[model samples]
Target: MSLPVHLAPSLTGVAPGETVEVTGDEAHHAVAVRRLRVGETVVLTDGAGTSVTGPVGSTGKRVFTVRVDDVRREPRPQPELVVVQALPKGDRGELAVEVLTEVGVALVVPWAAARSVAVWKGERAERSRAKWQATAREAAKQARRSWLPEVAALARTAEVVDLVAGADLALVLHEGADDALVHVDVPSAGRIVLVVGPEGGLSEAEVAALVGAGARSVRLGDEVLRTSTAGVVAAAAVLARTPRWG
Candidate 1:
C-alpha cells in the first residue's frame, strides 16, 4: 500500500538518515487525527517537486520527526495544463479547484467572467482565493502529487486573454462551437490552457474576445456540464492526448 503523503514547507537538501521535523497544523493532523506513531512510514513533499520518504522517529502533540530513508526530486511535468475557470456560485468554485488539482493541472486561474454570478471583492476576494489555494493543496497531497498546482490571483477578462494568447494551445469550452475537444491537436511540450465559462455560460462578446486572442472554440460533447465539472472533463480530454498521460 502507498504511504500517506504530508506536505512540508521545504524539503531541500533532505538526505537519507537525516531527521526532518514536521510542525504546526500539518504535524498535528498526522499525529492526533491520523494517529501517526513512531516508526510508521510516511512521505513528505514540498509540493515543488521535492519528496522524502521516511519513518516517524518521534511524535508530539503538534509535531513529529521523520528519519529520512530516501529522497526524490521530480522535474515539473511538461506540456503544462492550465485552466481558466470562471468563478462558480457558492462552494462550487472550491469543487472545481479541487478536481482540477487532482487531475494534474499545473495552474488554475480564477476568472471573473461577465456572466459570472459570483463576485470576489476586498476581504471576500482574499478569503475566496485562500480557500481555492487550500483546496488545491489538500487535493494534491491526496493525489500524491510531488508538484502542487498553483491557484493564481483572481483575473479579469483582459488578463485571461493574455494567457490564451501565450499558450501553445488554448481552447475555450463552448457548447455552440463547431469543433470537438477530441479533434484538437495536443502539443507534446509547452503549455496548454483551457477556458471554462461560468454557470450562466460565456457571453457572445466574451467568446469573441477569447477567440480573437487565439483560443480555439471547442465543445466537450452534446450534453452540457455544470461550471464545476466542465473544466475537469475538458482537462482530462486534453491531457489524455498528451505524452504526460501516455
Candidate 2:
C-alpha cells in the first residue's frame, strides 16, 4: 500500500463536500517533495481512521486545495492505554514517550520516582512537559491518528499514584512479582493504566506506596527491562489483552 497521506491543522475542520486549504509544512512537503499535483488523487487520513479520498486542486509553494470526495469516521480505540512511566535519565524518557505514542497509547504520564535521574521541576518541568507533548503530537501524526495522546505534567510518586487510582484497571510492572501479565485476566473495562518504574526499579517503599494507592503489582517476565522499554512492553501486553485490541 502507498503511504497514507497526512493532513495538518490547516486542512482540519474541512468536512465532506467542503474544500480544504492546506498550507505550511505539510503543503511544502506535499508540493515540493511529494510533487503532488492537480488532478492527482490521494488518501488523506486524519490519523484516527477517519479518511477522505480527495483529488488535489491548486498546488503551490505553501498552499494547496483539496476537495473532499469521501469521509469515513473511525471510532477511537477502546480500553485506552495510559502509561505512567518514571522519567529516565537523559533522552531515554523522550524515547519512551515517542515509542509509547507510536504504540497507540492514549496518555503518557512522566513520573518522578525515587531512583529517577531526570528531575522535571520548576521551569525545567514546564519545558520537559512541552517537549513530551510535542513528541506525542509528532508521533500521532506519523501514526495517522485522528486523536492525539495527552502528555501530562511531570508528577511526583504520590501524584502518579493518585492519577491511576481511578482507572478501571491499574497495574505496576515490577521484577520478581509472582503475578504474570499474560496470566492475569481483566474485565472489559475501557480504561486501563500501566505504571513503569525508573531504571533502578521502584524502591520497596515506593512499591508499597503504590500498592497502597490501589495499583496491583504485576510481573512482565523473568528478565528485567529498562525504564524506557518497560512502558511500551507493558502497554502492548495490556492492549493485547483488552477486547478492542482484537
Candidate 3:
C-alpha cells in the first residue's frame, strides 16, 4: 500500500536521517483526522518536484515530525499535458479537476466558453476556483504524485486562444470534427494542450478562433462525452501515445 502523503511548503536539501516539520492544516489533518502516530510511516511532498518518505517521529496538536528515510526529486514530466476545460455547471468542475489531476495533467485551465452554463463572476468565481485548486490538491496526494497539477484561473476564449497558439500540439474536441484524437502526433518533450467544450458545446466563432490559433478540431469517437469527463479521456489518449504513459 502507498503511504499517505501530506503536503509541505518545501523539502529543499532534505536528506536521509533528517527530521522535517509539517504544520498548519496539513499537520492538523495528519494528526487530528488521520491520527498518525510516532513510528507510523508516511510520505510528504512539496508538490513541486520533491517527495520524502519516513516514519513519524512525533505528533502535536497542529504539527508532526517525520524522520526522513528517503528523498526523491523528479524532473517535471514531458511532454506536458495541459487541458483547457470549459466550466461545467454545479459540482462537475471539482470532479473534472480531480480526475484530470489523477490522469497526470500538468495544468488545467478553466475556460468560460461562449456556451458554458455555469457563470463565474465576482466572489462566486473566487470560491469556485478555490474549490478546483483544493480538489486538485487532494487528488494529487491520492494519486501519490510528486508534482501537483496547476489549476489556472478561469480563462476567457481569447486567453485560451493564446495558450493554444503556443503549444507544440493543440487539439479542440468537437464531435463534428473529422480528425480523431488517437491519430494526432504527440511530441515527447513539448506541451500538448487539449480544449474541451461546454455541455452546450463550443460556439462556431470559438471554434474558428481556436482553430485559427493553430488548434486542430478533433474527436474522441462517435459517442459524445460530458465536459467534466472529456478532458481526462483526451488526456489519457495523449498520454497513451507518449512515453509518459509507456
Candidate 4:
C-alpha cells in the first residue's frame, strides 16, 4: 500500500536528514486515530509544491517528528482548472468540492446563482465555505496531491463574470446548447474556467452574462448530470486534453 500523506505547514527549505515536526490536530489524528508509530514511513506536503517522505522519529501526545529522507518540488500543473460551482443544497456542496479537488482542480469557487435554491447568508455562509474548504483539504490528502486546491469565497454572478472574462478559455454547462464539450479547444497554459450550475439550473440571464463574458455554452452529452457531479466530469474532460493528464 502507498504510505499515508499528511499536510505540513511548509516544506520550502526541507532536505534529507532533517527532522520535521507534525503537531496539533494533525498529529493527534495520525497518532491516536490512525495509530501511527515510530519508524513508520509517511509522506508530507505543504499543499503548495513541496513534498517529502520520511520515517517517524518520535511521538508525543499531540505531536510527532519525521526524519526526512526524500524531498520533491513539483511544478504547477498546466492549464489550471478553476470551476465556478453554484452552491448545491445540503451536503452536495461538500461532495462537489471533494471530487473536484481529487481530480486536480486548481480552484473551486462557490457561486450564488439566481436559480440556486441553497442560500449562504450570515453565519451559514461562513460555515458552508468552511465545509467546502475542509472537504477540499481532506480530499487532497486522500488523493496524495502535492498541491491542494483552493476554495474561493462565495461569488456573485457579477464576480463570476469577471472571472470568466479573465480566463484563457471558459465554458459553462448548458444542456440546451448546441455545442459539445469535446469540440471545444482546451488551452495548454493559463486558466481554463468552467461554470457548473445548481440543481435548478442556470437562468437564461446567467447563461447570457457568462457567454457575453467569453464562456462557451457546451453540453457533456444527451444525459444531464447532477450539479454535484457535473464539475468533475467537465473538469476531467478539460484535463484529458491537457499535458497535465498526459
RMSD of model 2 against the true structure: 2.6
Note the residue pairs that clash in candidate 1.
none
Candidate 1 lDDT over 1-246, as tens digits, reads 989999887898888999889899999999999999898999999999999998999999989999999999999998999999999999999999999998999999999999999999999999999999999999999999999999999999999999999999999999999999999989999999999999899999999999999999999999999999999999999889888899
**What TM-score do all the candidates reach, one by one?**
0.98, 0.86, 0.99, 0.99
Residues 1-246, model 2: lDDT tens digits: 644465645344657777777788878878998888898877566554566768887898988877888776667778778899898998887899999998889889888889988888789989988888878877876776766788987778788778777878889998968898998777666778888998888899988887888878999999899989988988888778677677
Candidate 1 global TM-score: 0.98
Which is better, 2 or 3, measured by lDDT?
Answer: 3
Q: List residue ranges in candidate 1 displaced over 4 A.
A: none
> What is the RMSD, in Å, between candidate 3 and the native fold over all Cα?
0.7
Better TM-score candidate (2, 4): 4
In candidate 2, position 62 carries an lDDT of 89
- What candidate 3 gets wrong by more than 4 Å, as runs, is none
Best by lDDT: 1
What C-alpha lDDT do the candidate models reach, one value each?
Answer: 0.95, 0.81, 0.94, 0.94
Q: Report lDDT (Cα) of residue 146, candidate 1.
A: 100
Model 2: number of backbone collisions: 5
Which window of ten consecutive residues has the lowest lDDT sum in model 3? 1-10
- Give the Å shift of residue 237 in candidate 4: 0.9
Q: Residue 36 CA error for candidate 4 (Å)?
A: 0.6
User: How well does candidate 4 match the true structure, expressed as C-alpha RMSD?
Assistant: 0.7
Stretch of 10 with least lDDT, candidate 4? 6-15
